[model samples]
Target: LEPLWLVGHTFAENTVGRLMERPPAVFATGASVGSVIEALREIVKQRMVTYVFVIEPAGRLVGVVAFRELVFADPNQTLDQIMLREPFSLRPQQPFVDAMREVVKRHYPVYPVCDDAGHLLGVVKGQTLFEQQAFEISAQAGSMVGVEKEERLATPWSRSFRFRHPWLLINLLTVFLAAAVVGFFESTINQLVVLATFLPVLAGQCGNLGAQSLAVTLRGMTLGELRGMSKLRLVGKEAWLGLLNGLVTGVVAGVGMYFASRGQTVADPVWLGAVTTAAMALCCALSGIAGATIPIVMRRMGADPATASGIFLSTITDISSMGVFLGLAALLLA
Candidate 1:
């Protein structure tokens, strides 16, 4: 082992080496096609076969021959002449992200894992590499919304309570902040009872918009697509989306509420309806920023971006939405 680094070094847990399966079919390059056929027979009898790796005397990978290629080849043909030379391989130390990129490009069913010096270690199934992480990526959606991925449908009640309650308390505190905003506009609510009617409607819109952005942001993070992307660009993109979406939805909501408020006794119904439109646009735009920014900041600080992001986003959206809605109503009507 003159170059001991390849043989002895430990890869980080998520690297291709840890997840790779034991080599299904492997033989020395010196073996004849007949001997390779016998080896395949024995190997297939013991386990499923995919590809046969051809290695050298020192166990360095030289080439590969797929099961179909070997089955169709003439038994008289030597492995040296038959095996495809210098096949694609992942080094044991390669990061999972790098391996995934390679897998995407090659679209191979199984890939060989090797050392830096090209000694074959094992092979990784494309499905095994992706399926495990697929669970992780999908589970992240629930985790963002304060649901623990590990908390199964059969999870004990006590465990469920323990998982959800802490964030629930944090959420409760945020609700009070929104409540306090309402308390600040107490006089206005008393004067114009109709403003209270659309309160839930406006809050719901902001909360939902924030959630939509949060889900998209988390998906980008999971795919490693956000790394090369500028943070400002992500923020800008969401902001513009929120603006356009908010403007259209807000106008509709405002008009709808205006009709609903016609019979209510208010000093200035028109001004109150105008406030709803303004608050909707403002809250939604701010929520989009909060949703996008929270996850990015969480990742930057080495925290799981998905951890309770929905709770935080909701809290922020609630406070801003209520504050703008109520503050505007007070200024206009009371």
Candidate 2:
């Protein structure tokens, strides 16, 4: 029941050993159902008992007997007669995150922790396992935007500043890349001022598309759902999604562009609209690919996938959207 913080352990750094509690109900292989029930009468007084573990003389976990099974079984039956053999277990030294992945689908109220030799060491409450993981998952959004996972609301201003300032500098550098793309198209913007009005629109839409892909990719990775799936396939799927979404949104944006520039005489409004439509679709597709790819690449490099992924994604989407939008305007209209 001790809080992880009190022991200077973060969720990510914890192992099953740190979270394990002494097993509440354990019996040798030959223990009878009546005797186990008798033992549980006193066991329940001190702590909760969900499952009865059957262990060998060497303390190796042999099987598990649920309480319901015990209640219905013949009182003379030995544990070996009713216990489920080769039950799943968690190793004490296994990382909490790994254990979480292993147990996510089991939904057991408690899990037995054992050594490499399968000797029963202790038990970990399912609630404790999930609570730690939930905390880690909750911090992912902050990590995506350059906030350190360790920075809590109670963190001092100075420490928060130190945690956040470096990423802001990196963000500034990326902003300049986007700015340079715009600067590269400076003449195009000057000639067609309407394009300037829609620059934010394109960037905003593509950035949003990229964020969607990023969020899904990170979630899949966290939940271990990405296993057995090809990373290339994931990126391709996101790109396809982006293309479809962009096509739909782009038409609306194109119509808006057509109306916004109707009063202007610099270029044909129809062609301008087409340029917007094309740029939006192309940039969104690219943004989706970038979004999915960035995190995968980061993970391959041994960096946390959620760490500043949003910042990197924003830079990519901004550059692609603006560069494509203005480049298209210049090519087709100018």
Candidate 3:
């Protein structure tokens, strides 16, 4: 007899179970070759079959045999003699993404679905799983910048505005905070005046660098590389990368600032250059740490690292870049 599920509930929506169809041919462990061939003739007309599954007397899945094996076998042979005892199969409860991952390298036309005890449930096509995965991944493209998970591509423009504006407004608040940092160093800005001109240049560069780090961290998480890796080690690696990159970029930005300052009417070009250089290096290094740390912290706090990480990192980069640039000027050049 078929599993009870096949008669009543069938497959569940948005799961591998839902994607599965009743196998074209399923047999008990004791089934004879002649019986399987007769069943195959009826099934082959309805669907293609590359393999046939063999199950135990108690309805537990036991093995599989290529369709060719059945045609060539002696009519008296039992399915047990011809079947490959250990066959790959999916569980009825597996999500589409995990199922797709499992079947990535498999080139089978069909696969059996089973329960925890290996009872044969149904069969699913490999192509259906791949199609669902592609659709799911493409739908999530907007998730990186704080888009709501429920938002769809065909969502009304009004709904899209509602979904988007909240984050934009939050970003505006962080921009104000960055402005407040510069406001704190007004005395330094007043003394040189030229320092005000380079503020955006400094902040924008660090923000871009921080965004790069955030992208890489999110990618690692998505690929499941962070699963068994040490969080501290990941943090340490980002910090070192930040420092080394800052040193190189800081030297270049310093040279450019030094030359740029020569054309300005500043009282102390060398001191101004030194301050900008020091601020660049300091802000960039901290921004890297911020980029790496924010996502990890979000993950630990049970928030999605991808959705909110950009917002946290933006706040860090803007505040750190401006704060360091102006604070260094106040301490050195003011």
Better of 1 and 3 by lDDT: 1
- Who wins the TM-score comparison? 2
| Local distance difference test, each candidate | 0.80, 0.89, 0.78
TM-score per model over all chains = 0.79, 0.82, 0.81
Check candidate 3 and list the clashing pairs.
none
lDDT tens digits, residue span 174-252, model 2: 9999999999998988887878899999999999999999999999999888889999999999999999999999999
Candidate 1 global TM-score? 0.79
Output the worst ten-in-a-row residue range by lDDT, candidate 3: 2-11
Per-residue alpha-carbon lDDT of candidate 3 for residues 229-319, written as tens digits (9 for 90 to 100) = 9888877777777777777777777777777778756446777777777788778778888877877888898876777577778788888
Query: Model 1, which residues run further than 4 Å from truth?
Result: 1-18, 71-80, 91-101, 115-117, 187-193, 220-234, 256-266, 300-302
Q: What's the CA error at residue 218 for candidate 3, in Å?
A: 2.8
